[model samples]
Target: MHNEGKTKMIPFGDLSREYDDLSIEIDNTVAGLLKSGWFVLGKKVEEFEEVFADFIGKEVFAVGVGSGTEALHLALVASGVTHGDYVITVPNTAVPTVSAISFSGATPLFVDIDPDTYNIDTNKLRELVVIEKKRRGNKLKALIPVHLYGQSADMEPVLAIAREFNLTVIEDACQAHGAEYKGKRVGSFGDYACFSFYPSKNLGAYGDGGMITTKTPEQAHTLKMLRNYGQEKRYYHTIKGFNSRLDELQAAILLTKIKYLDTWNTRRRDIADFYNQNIKNKAITKPVEVSYGKHVFHLYVIRHPERDRLQAYLQNNDVQTVIHYPLSIHLQEAYKDLGYSQGDFPVAEKVAEEILSLPIFPQLRDKEAETVAELINSFS
Candidate 1:
C-alpha cells in the first residue's frame, strides 16, 4: 500500500520546471532583445558576464563560450599549455576533462583518484611531478583538478602542490556550483576556473553555455579576444582563433536564473543531508563532505559493492539512477595510445565499477528523499 504513494517516476535530473520558474523574466528579456534587434555578444551577454563574474568572486571577463568543453579549451590556451606538453589530471571524471587537454594540443597524463574523495589525489600528483621532472625535466606544465559531484577536490593540498612546482592549476569546476572550502568558493582558488552551463549542472543554462573565471587582466583579455576571432578591434585580427562565443539567448536565460542559484543550491544541500541521514545500508558508502568544505551536492553518489545489482534494484522500484561515468578516461577505447591497462590505476577502476549517482536535483519533491531512502534500506 505504501508503494502506491511513490511519485510517478524519479528522473536522474529533471528540468521541466526550469523554464516555468523564470518564464516571466525570460520572456521580458527576449522581447527586449527582439525590440533592440541586437543579438550575439549584445548587452545581455555583457551584463550577465559582469554579474556572473562577481557571483563567483573573481574578476572574470566572462567570455561566453559555446560549451563547457570550449571553456576548458580556451582556459588551457590562455594558461599557455603548449603543444605536446604534459598536463596532469585524474581519470575518474567526465570525458570533457581529457578532451580539453587534447583540444589544446597538450598530452593528458591520466592519474588515479582518492579512494574517498573521488578527486585527483594531490599526494600522488607530487610523485608524478617529481618523477616526470626527473625523467623528462621541464616537459610538464599544468594540473587540472575536477571538483566532481560538487565537492572541492581537496584544493588546499592541490593548491599547495601546484604553487610549489609553479604549475598552472585550471580547475574543472564544471560540476561544482556554489561549492566552497575553508569559507572560500571553488572558482576563486585556482589560476583559472572553468564552468559548464549544461542544463544538468547545479548552475545550468537553458542550453549549452560556459564561462571562465580568472583574476589576471591579461588572461581575461586574451580569453575575450580568443573567443571573438582574436580581434580586439572591428575587422582586425591579431592572431588566428576559432568561433566559440556564447550565444545571447543562453546568456539572457542564465542571467534570469542566476538570481536564485544560491537558494536552489541550499535545497540540493538539504536533500543530500536527508539522504545521508536516512539511507543506511552497510553495503553502501554514502558521499562524505570534508570537515572544511560546503558541498553543493550536484550529484548524491553512493559507492556500492554490488553496484550493478543496486542500480537494477532501484530501477525495479521505479527509482531512477545513473553512473556519472562507467569508464575511466585512460581505459576508454579511444585513448589506447595512453596504453593504460587494467590494474594501472586501481582506485579509478574501482570507482568506475562501484560509484552510482542517485536522483538529487534541487527541485526534488520533499517526499522523494524519504521514499528513496526507504527503498534503499529495503535493497538488501
Candidate 2:
C-alpha cells in the first residue's frame, strides 16, 4: 500500500504514538498525582490494584509490584518455593521468567513447548513431572506456565498436572493482559498470575511496573508485606521483604490506560487479521489461534525456514521486524549451570531459529500492515 517511489519505514512498535493518543488524559492524571505530593504506594496504587484485581476475575486480589520478575519471585516465595526446590517452566520464554525462578533460590527446570501453540506442552510437562518426582521427591515446588504471545497455555491440563504432582501453579502472564482461556481470563487460573506493564506491553505503563493476582486473601496480605519491607503497619517488620512497591505515578498512568486496554487489544487483533488474510506467501507460516480462547495477539509472529534471509529482505525494504527470541533460555550462557545441553529442548530451539515478530500495535495503520505483508510476500 506504500508508494512505489518512496518506501515507508514501519517500526516494530511505536510507544510514542500510544502516548500521543492518550497524552491529555495521561498528562492530566500525572499532573493530578504531582499535585498530591505522595509518590509511592499511595491512593492511585491501591485504586489500580483494586480495579485490576476485579478485571482478572471474581474474588481475585492484585498486588502491584516493581516489575514482572519481582511479581513472579514474590509469588514463588509466598508459595514457599525456596532453596533446593525445583520449579518447572518452558525454555522458550523471555529470560525474566527463568530469572524470577532463580531469584527465589529455586532451581529452574525446562520442558519443551508445543510446536503449534508455542506453549508448554502438557504431555511433556506431565512426563517430566513424573520423572522429577521419582528422582527428586517433594523437591519440585512450583510450575510456572508462561502464556507466551498472549495465548493461554491450555490451562485445563496444566492445572490438572499441577494438582496431580502437588506443585503450586504460577501463571507468567507478562505478555497476556486481557487474554482468556475457555472464556475465563488468564490471570484467574493459576494460584498466582504475574503481569508486566513495561513500555511496550499490550497494557503497558510509562515505565516498569508489574502485578500479581491471587485468589487467597492470606496470600494477598503476605504479598503486600513482602513488597514493602515486610511491614504490616508503618515500620513494623514481620518478615524479610524487598523494596518492590509499585509507585503512585505509574499506577495513575495505568489507571488511565486500563480503560482502553480492551480497545487497544481489539485493534491489535484487527491488524493480525489483516496480516493473516493478506500475507499469501506459502513458505511463511502464520500464527494460529487456539479453539478454546481469545488471543490478544500481543506479538503477531510468523515463521519461515529462511528466517534470516526474510528478515534481511524486510529490513532492506524498510519494513522493520524482530525475533521474539533468538535463543532459548536453556541454550543461553547464563543458564548453562542448569545443566541443559544443546539439544535439551529441540522444539523450542527450532522455533527460536524460525520465529519473527512483525509489527502489531493499536496505532499501526491498516495500510502499514498490508505493506508489511506485501513485503514479506515478495521475499524469496
lDDT of each: 0.86, 0.93
- What residue pairs are clashing in model 2? none
My TM-score estimates for the predictions, one after another, are 0.96, 0.98
Q: What's model 1's lDDT at 176?
A: 91
Weakest lDDT window of 10 consecutive positions for candidate 2: 1-10
Q: Estimate, for each residue in 288-353, the C-alpha lDDT of model 2 and write its tens digit.
A: 999998999999989999899999998888888989899999989999898999888999999999
On lDDT, the leading prediction is: 2
Residue 68 CA displacement from its true place in model 1, Å: 1.2
TM-score: which candidate is best? Answer: 2
| C-alpha lDDT of residue 375 in model 1 | 92
How far off is model 2, as Cα RMSD? 2.0
- Those runs of model 1 whose alpha carbons end farther than 4 Å from true positions after fitting are 1-7, 58-61
